[model samples]
Target: MAYCYTASIFFPSSSSSSSILANDRLPHLAYRPAKIKRRLSFSCAALPFDLSPPPIDHDLLDTMTVAGAKVSEDGVIGTFDNDDEALDAVENGVAVVDLSHYGRIRVSGEDRVQFLHNQSTANFEILHEGQGCDTVFVTPTARTIDIAHAWIMKTAITLVVSPVTRERIIDMLKKYIFFADKVEIQDITQQTSLFVLIGPKSDQIMEALGLADIVEQPYGSHKHYSVNGMPITVGVGNLISEEGYSLLMSPAAAESVWKVLLGHGAIPMGSNAWETLRILQGRPAPDKELTDEYNVLEANLWNAVSLNKGCYKGQETISRLVTYDGIKQRLWGIRVSSPVEPGSTISVNGKKVGKVTSFTTGKRASQPLGLGYIKRKAASEGDSVIIGDDVEGTVVEVPFLARQIPPS
Candidate 1:
């Protein structure tokens, strides 16, 4: 059993540590935190960005959208036309999403692997050439610095990181350098174009785009190819779904790649569809859900946090939580009758127990689907919750009915 101190801190009642979820029992929770606590109110999404607008035609995107949501601070579209159109694109047609917001960092030098190995949760020492791994860089207290994907190229490691946490990630990674290490970090986000492709036909479409050799490669693995005499980097596996790849190419080649993908049955999807599917798969955007307010375990980032890995920035705190107090709450799926917004309060039997981190209406279903952290005692498979205005939501399994990929 554990007692909630403030929203983010917990103290265990017993010295014997129990596995997070075991013996068909809920972890005992006591002394819930009050709503007056301000620690949980910090939002990374509320921060400012000075990003240049993407090269895509904003006028055309604005005209196409009936309703819109921006994945970034700039005028990026979350959905073009409507959620239904984007949903149809994902399920039936190939969907292409502009991910210019995702930041890219190149870590190079002789000590690059060892340098990253000391900072992230994954074991980068074993990350071979052309291989990749999903990892997290965390604070000394184990709060998420960023959830990132490291693609180990022949001479350097490319870290594709969350948009909202981009600057912080780069700064911290650079700040932690010792004079002895030989790593050099470079931000290449502006020089490169990132596009995510999703659907059952995504692989086939990728093949048609001169990425056939890398289409079936696993997540984090990338291959450099020349398309139209321009260098392109193809990464297989979509972070949002079972089928897809992240295509990275120079800005000069973006238009050509976009046209090729669109011509080969890739439907343009805006931030709305991309976000809806992301929430459906229980993946939280750092801006919407990740902040110092939450830890990796509570964020449902089990895939990114490597408990067995050697010491890293936050290893001490992570090990302590996993072994002792455990997580008091965890991100869970919620189904509501109406659309619920992020920052929405979640109560169990009229007690404020959680907060909505990410939310959206089902594309075709048009009912509400969301992800939020619920107290351990309140987070059972069929538990129910009350959101704003008496709307009721049931705790459902994450991924809300979608194809699942192998955990990273």
Candidate 2:
């Protein structure tokens, strides 16, 4: 009989899994609404699969319509709204979208820090109280195991990675545990909930809920706080003009937090809006674009890596790629004349050169754009590439949106 699991935390038998040595480590880790709150009906009784897929219960489509967001399911559609309500919700107020499908993993034990630092692409030792980082976990050969946001609570490190790569992340991390001391890995994805607070006014929203005091810090930094009196682990970062804070807490707290945001005038956005924002910002997500073959450098994750840090697993390869300028391809955003699917191939002069990773109808710019991995030398803003007949795209900068100052 075949067994299946929704996440990548399961331990394989000794004979089935390879005991690989890890060189180093790294880290990291949304919401919804009502009125539009309808009980979704998805039938699984007659389906061939025995396992039940998690249902989409947020009344996502209605929520988007009521909020006046342009809604499309093809991954490129945005809701049609006057006053740019989607953008407004992300600017002046807060928004919650379903992010449960994203992957998450936890690392614990006395050696967790040492193990992660050696295997990850960032400097874990510099992680202090109220700090987080964007980083990558790599295999011994320098392939990316997972791109993650790492947060440290005391000595415990939590990595919120892409679900598509969750298994490899677990397998890869476990491979390096031979003879390591006291490190227990757990997959707490189902037990915990993820809620994101994004907008220029995000701080105010947090303040209203008593999450934190206003302060100056980089995008990947955060502090512990409470929401509606519920304790939560918080991590913050800049996603375009909107500063983002992710709440790691219980499901009950998750619902209460969403209610509080709605009461505070936050526009509840659907997953569609979130996807559009992510693509427009050039953030690489798993399955949609991020994969094993893509390295951190090519994925535009430079801000996440710390060169001054000591050796970790795959450091030699990463160092060489960073200094030697030997990476052949790099990920870039492009303005395309036509819509392309996520996995569509990109070409130049009739030769295959790259592949499209994510595409979106820019709700703000009123144009279609895509994220793709192209040959490094050929990947430049304003450079034109062809996808199909009469379908051409021009390379553009990573982040199409500008940042805004927090309220004083």
Candidate 3:
């Protein structure tokens, strides 16, 4: 039986009917509106949404309700205790984070490989079953739509993307479908739950859970396992730590799996800790670094883009940027003296150079750290810059661990 689903696309609400076209900025490209505020809907065959698990109850844990601490938009706990304790758990021990908010889409049929290869930046044709690779979807002008990790399974390719971009990515994929192409796209997000184990002791915890083999697998590789009758697919990857593994399972098994991990000495981390960890790792977040405002190169996502691959959307723009050295700005790490808001300007010698995109207090250090896109010429590692007027900051390398002095 096929279930039908509808996704709504809402355009920007503005008084001006005039819209900016992509060709206006890049004359060689076909015209596409930069903004449209009308609400439109599309329908496709999908599994029942009811299959998704309900939001995790924070009351189940001895959570701390501090100011600025709350549930994430994705419905996961934002803070179990304090951010510092959470960071300590990740650095010195093991921590389990709920990532059920991430989206999962399954693409199947004989043409799946070729179709995905032409849709995203990664060379999907080279991925064999049980292997995975991170890929980015871009516009015709090479602007980022989203970054997804595709795991090749026996019957289909499972794409895990940020929750914010899930619907849009699915819509884009469906719109690109051709009548002669043998491809099927299904939203399996509701049917599955995703969680991550991070930190130095993550391997120990995995082994205790009877996933010793997964700890030895290379990044982007996964294996299936069953724990107490709950089927799980464990994948190796670095989400917020060098030692990290992701577990994907049915929604019905999520709670049990989470408890079992905690019972084995894994600290429960919430989004508050996640934000601090991600910023420290220099990993981009949805609607922050992974937006249309920046392209793949500017976002420093070269690892995810395959330069030698055949034509795909935005291939020309990416190639031109590389061939011409036209990347104006690049994402960088910043160590700030005090708290700063997103969109805070970064300047040097009284000149504006960049803007802070993501920031978090140093739960594991002395000051705040952030991610921003800076003009390549304006700053370099170890250089000092002004953030939002008089606040001073230093440009630093990402995975910002050098300055993480443990608090007294």
Candidate 4:
């Protein structure tokens, strides 16, 4: 097994032989200096406008009841009586959420399709109107730069990546466009708006907004429709257990749209609430649970990787890794009693096997749960491990239960 070092660095090209070393007295894992420029800080102002007051020292929210717990810190928002109830809220009830932490980029120009096809893991050229896909952009050496979801719009290509990879993705794209045709990259994270709706009742909210005749489709399916007689675009994603849909609109239309949904009975959930939902479902978010160091297979990103799709960057490594069973680690979920923190080591039989990436507590006083990367041999559900120093945790199967998706 590779030894843990302190420095965090990007492995740009497969052939490049530079290795990072860390000398700090912290965790003994290898570290590579993060490449992002710290131009924006959490203390800095939120772009466009700041809706809430300045963040308090303890900004975490709690949603608990007398019978059960809400969500815990580290971003778990609410607590439902059971898994089915939580899924029901997503499928049939309104689940208003704030995904502002997600990074957004805009690609425009005649060559946008070709440009993205060359840079992303998925076949961008195959994407038609109203459809979007999950893809990863990696360095020549196959280290991940960003995991992004891309959509084709009338005038531009919109990409949503993690905050950590936003700048690196932009820079990488720029370097690749050296001899390419017309293409412009712009950060439009704040200029545009995004929201998610999942459930049988979701249609009611869309219909309330005047989004008529919206045809139902499966995950990875999408189409253009009008809401409230206003032109809006929709994308289908991550609906393994319900009718799921993601909504995109101009910033100007966001407030009005939010009000309409609330009036239609949608529950305005914070970021933590949505994240807990995602984690419980085995979904991986950029940087938080996935990064450049992981291959698509290791990250359980099969939904996004199309085997039949033609060649793209890093396809060779993916194919080789899959064919040879070369995946070294797997991202899986675990339930722990102790508070788990990201970057902590996960051990089995007293040997280092994996590391924790994301962890959260119960809404009020429930047990702690976390998502971590583990050696494939150590990944079975019900397996046990220790987190941080003394926190005890157990591995659990994803989705935490059976998932049901709506009809196409």
Candidate 5:
């Protein structure tokens, strides 16, 4: 059975003076529609075998036809209300987006910490309750496989992963289990909703929603609290450089949570908006920046790994690379003269030296910024690289935030 309601209500007219609350007196969680609501017949039950329904009200989203780009089978919005507004919200104001489309696994048992510590780039042994850290999973050859956020909680350590590598990571974890190490993996993505709030105003938005203030929390630390009568985990951290927060809640409460955030001035964004921000921030994404083609060293994820930590899978090669400075190509930012396609050849004079990985325009900087891997020999800070015929690009510092660094 599919639930539906009038499209107008979902994107209520800005001028309409009528309140959506039950009576303007009901608590946010207790409010029920005083008027009878209709549920139209529209089935969205069947989806691609490899995909899951986006943990959102597709019926309501479909009615929001004015904004957003293509709708994925999982109902992911490629863009919502134009990239410009989304960019503005994330760069200058508060923005919210559902990341339930990503993959997550719950790992438990006595050996959870040791098991993870052996497999990832980060030292998980130090993780205590309410702490989290960014880590990378590499193959025996030290090639990047996945980058995940490990959340230490009372019941389990939750590993949030990219949907592209969810199955592979699970298989790897299952394959390496020694049978007595005591570890279990459970996919919790379908049952939970992960919403990201970013921009400087993110903390204020959370406060407006009556959630615990996050400005005081240290980065990567998460805390649980009740909001709208729903229990949620709020993680304090940004994608890379800017201020950001992650809200984790049960799927049953997703719609209500989304509605409350939006009502409190949190702008709704989409994947395109997210991709643009990440690329500009020099953050790597699974299957793109995080792939077998590159290693953790080449990806410049220095914070994800610790040299003092002892042996684990692929530790030798990674250690050797660090000590010997064996990295060939490194991720860098490219300032383009014009919009260029991702994966377009980046060349010097006439020879190709690198390839564009991600690109975006209409940004806060009002420049066409991109990120890609450039060979150590060819890339130089502020040196221009050739594109097709007319387009050219100059190497720029990554994390593409204002604090600049010379290209290595």
Candidate 6:
């Protein structure tokens, strides 16, 4: 006797599912009776496949808004009040900057170290558990990709990358994976949050939070801790300030941790304040100072590049530049007589020497300060240059604080 069988499948009734699946891919039930009188029927249901990102924590957003945070379009706090007060907090007291938006990725497996070593500019093979260092990802032609800070854990290495370059870096790393290599890359950016505590009082605040041990550790040293059932990892690093401590925790734990630090007198800082401080520190930021338009050396990120490291992407070009002094332009600090827009040209005697990448109204310095790339042969510290058309400025040493003190 012949038998007929049919199957039916149902997916969630949502626009997301409809957009994700095509009509032909959607299965339906069909039955044809033959000599047999009986027919079999099977039914299946499939969950909707949603490709949207997770929603932001509204509770945390509301809390910050209530606390007088000027939230940016990206949802980060831009400034609680003004940049000047935040600058003061960084120099005198502790200031907390939410860096949760930064990208976080976890690299696991036995070959993770060697895999990263071959991909980036740092010597990752030498790092031990609890150690971390900044590294740069570059193209084959030695153009800047992004500078990532890696924290070595017992089982995996956690990479903190720029939010803009997160997906690109992940895709780039995955493309290099081979069948013989044992490596896994997981993007944990949404799963975790990061905060940076800056200022001279950062150590004191850590002690108050019962993290005195972390404060004593050197830069790039991290230790994990469980605080009231929430897992948190504290690390020492000079991200924006000379004495900065980074706290990595779950999104759910961010509110509580932020409150705890605030209870200990940590001021809330925002992006405006961050930009001013970053320019003052002479730190290269993604798309601004760190970009494919310039090489890593030209960005003045030599500390992040390891000269003794083995072969890596763009290694040959980087080595040649160093050996032959091929780097023509170098990042420098410019003290402008007035505010100047980024992308403004820096000229000497009507000849184009460089262009500004970052410009900030010096609320702390009571002047306009900027960072840009200048031809090494055209400018030196204390050389006068014209910003834009007629705005006069002088080339100064980076970490602008070294050349002039911030006003009290």
TM-score against native, each model:
0.78, 0.73, 0.80, 0.70, 0.80, 0.82
Tens-place lDDT per residue, model 3, 301-388, is 7777888887999999998998888989988899999889999999999999999999988776675898999999999889999999
> Which digits, one per residue and each the tens of the lDDT, describe model 5 over residues 1-408?
453332221211222223122121101122222232222222222211122334435443454344444667776777764677877887688888777778878887788888889988889877787788888899998899877887787657888888888899998988888968888777777766788888778878655544443556776887654332334567887545436888776554555567667777888888877887778777887777777888887777777776767998889988888778798888888888788887788888788888787788846548788788888888777988986555888988765333322234
Q: Which pairs, if any, clash in model 5?
A: 68-79
Score each candidate by Cα lDDT. 0.66, 0.61, 0.72, 0.58, 0.69, 0.73
Clashing pairs in 3: 11-36, 11-37, 12-37
RMSD of 3: 15.3
Q: Give one digit per residue, the lDDT tens place, for model 6 in 91-133.
A: 7987888887788888888899999999998899888887888
**C-alpha RMSD by candidate, in order:** 18.1, 12.3, 15.3, 16.6, 8.9, 15.5
Off-target runs (Cα >4 Å) in candidate 2 are: 1-84, 212-215, 227-230, 238-242, 400-408
List candidate 6 segments past 4 Å from native.
1-58, 400-408
Report the CA-based lDDT of candidate 4 relative to the real structure. 0.58
Better of 3 and 5 by lDDT: 3
| Decoy 5 TM-score against native | 0.80
lDDT of 3 at 278: 85
For residue 274, model 3's alpha carbon misses the true position, in angstroms, by 0.8
Model 4, range 1-408, lDDT digits (tens) per residue?
A: 232212111111212222111121111112232222111111211111222232322122321223244544433434444444444467557565545446678787889888888777777777775567777777654555656877766567778777667887888788778665899888766545576775567767645443333436544554443222223355665322335567655443454455455567866664555566666666666676656667666776665555556677777787777778787877788888777678999988778888988876644436367888899887567888877667777888676222312112
Cα displacement (Å) at residue 93, model 2:
3.8
**Per-residue lDDT tens digits of candidate 2, residues 1-408?**
332212111111222112111111212211111111112122111112111222324233354456565655542224344334655677566665545445667888888878888878788887764567767776665666666777775647778787677777888788788784678777766655676767777777655543344234565665443222223465675333226677665443444445555676676665667777788787877665556778766676666667778787777877788677778897888899868887788888888888888898777657698988899776576888987555888988865212211112
The best candidate in terms of lDDT: 6
Q: Is candidate 4 or 5 superior in lDDT?
A: 5
Task: For model 1, give the 10-residue run with minimal summed lDDT.
Answer: 19-28
Which candidate model has the greater TM-score, 1 or 5?
5
Clashing pairs in 6: none
